[model samples]
Target: MKTKFTAILLLQLLLISCSGTISTLKKEYSFNTSSSLKSNWNFNPKEWALEKDTLTGTGGPMHWGVIESRKQLPENYEINFRVNMTKESLFEVMLNLDKEKYIRTYLYQINQNIVIGDGVYDKKDDSYGKRGGKSLFTKPMELQNNKWYSVKIRVQNNQLYFSVDNKITLECSLEKSNLSQKGKLGFITNGETKITDLTIKTL
Candidate 1:
């Protein structure tokens, strides 16, 4: 009888934990009018423009258009969006960005940007990093040019959650980092990358 009671209690706790995660997610903000992205979000090169619904970031060194909002983001949050890469092998997102310090804060709740690129699983070192990089996938996992991929991210305290196309790939904790500063969310695009349907939500 005692063992049965313990099993029932454990089952109830599991259900409650699952339900709590399901209930905490809520949408916060979404963007429109990328054509006027310049007036809204901060970007360099002045060479880039919001043509229709997407911000077309051109390639090259200084031309690697960096797009980040001046608005400081909340402590724990989720960001979801779609990215279409064109002929480029890489792109990056920024989290807990300290523009003043030119670096990222110790990720509060997995505080790092979602970086999806060609494979490099074992090529990491102690300083292994992207947007304070957390993980890398295989070359086959690389984003295909001209194809749109859904990227979703959830950050809470010291853990970072990442998913692509509804497929959850990474959940990492920041061990070397400890700074929890709040800053703007941003991205730096290499090659031709277009961003659309960006939504930010609080947890």
Candidate 2:
């Protein structure tokens, strides 16, 4: 009877340990209200606005607008959002953004191409430079202005998986990218763009 009780206790402990490995952190944003957007994000009011369940950013020649989340993300996570281009523009999703490390994945609406790159920050001048950028797909995907597209990105074990509208998918290794284990997520637009239905899940 003593041995049987000990085995049962051991099994319970094992179950608890397994459950602890799974994470339950999640965040969702609908962009339905200005108050929620102000509380959870940082952006320039002159360039971005929240209205009608959408966050819109207007850009022009030599002008790029950015909005960043206040919360930092976990190492292994998934992000989902929808984007609509008002015109031909450059839309970028930035992850693991810190003072020195970041990863940027962007789509050029003019060319219908997707690219991923590492960010370079200049501490002396407080500006960013370009580095280590590559195209994800060899063929350009069809893109149109004034149309909404669903975007999903998953990061796990130093690997990144990206997909758009469930039609095009790409994966890349980040093991040697020197990115931060955890950091903020942000979006950048070089022309008019609207974003909504942002969700994040950590594993």
Candidate 3:
């Protein structure tokens, strides 16, 4: 009887260990209400608005806008969101941002080219200074305005992966970059765009 009891205890301990290994870092945002947005994000009220479960950003020429999350992200994680560009312009996802450095994954609507790069942040001006970027595709991909597209980004062990509609995938190495390992997530736009269904999970 002692032997059987010991075996059962061992099994229970093993099960507990396995369960503890599972990740517990899933977060979802539907953008269905203003309370959550007001509490969790930083953005300019004049440039961004929430309507019908969508967060819309309206930027004019020389007037870019950014909506940054209040929570700092984990070092290794995945992020997903849906975006619709109301007009052809620059849309970028900023990651691992500190006061002095950041990583930018951006798509140019005019050419449909996806690019990733390292950026210098100017804290005094609250603006980006200089950046060096690389295009993911040799040829320009086809993209259209006024349509929703699903975007996914994964960061793991100083590696970054980006995808659009699960059709085009790009990877980059952040080992030598100056960006922080864990930092805030943000969206930057230079024209009108709408976003919804943002989610993030740790690896």
- The local distance difference test score of each candidate is 0.53, 0.70, 0.70
lDDT of candidate 3 over 109-199, digit per residue (tens): 7777776777554523543344323443322567778888899999998888888889887787777644456678777777888887666
**Candidate 1: Cα lDDT at 67:** 65
Predictions ranked by lDDT, top down?
3, 2, 1
Q: Report the candidate with higher TM-score, 1 versus 2.
A: 2
Tens-place lDDT per residue, model 2, 10-43, is 9975653333121224434324467767777778
**Comparing candidate 1 with candidate 2, which one achieves the higher lDDT?**
2
Q: Residue 75 error for model 2, in Å? A: 1.4
- Output the number of the TM-score-best candidate: 3
The lDDT of model 3 is 0.70
Per-model TM-score on C-alpha atoms:
0.61, 0.76, 0.76
Give the Cα RMSD of candidate 2: 8.3
Q: Report clash pairs, candidate 2.
A: none
Candidate 2, which ten residues in sequence have the lowest lDDT sum? 16-25
**TM-score ranking, best first:** 3, 2, 1
Model 1 vs. true fold: TM? 0.61
Off by over 4 Å in 1: 1-30, 34-36, 45-47, 61-63, 100-140, 175-181
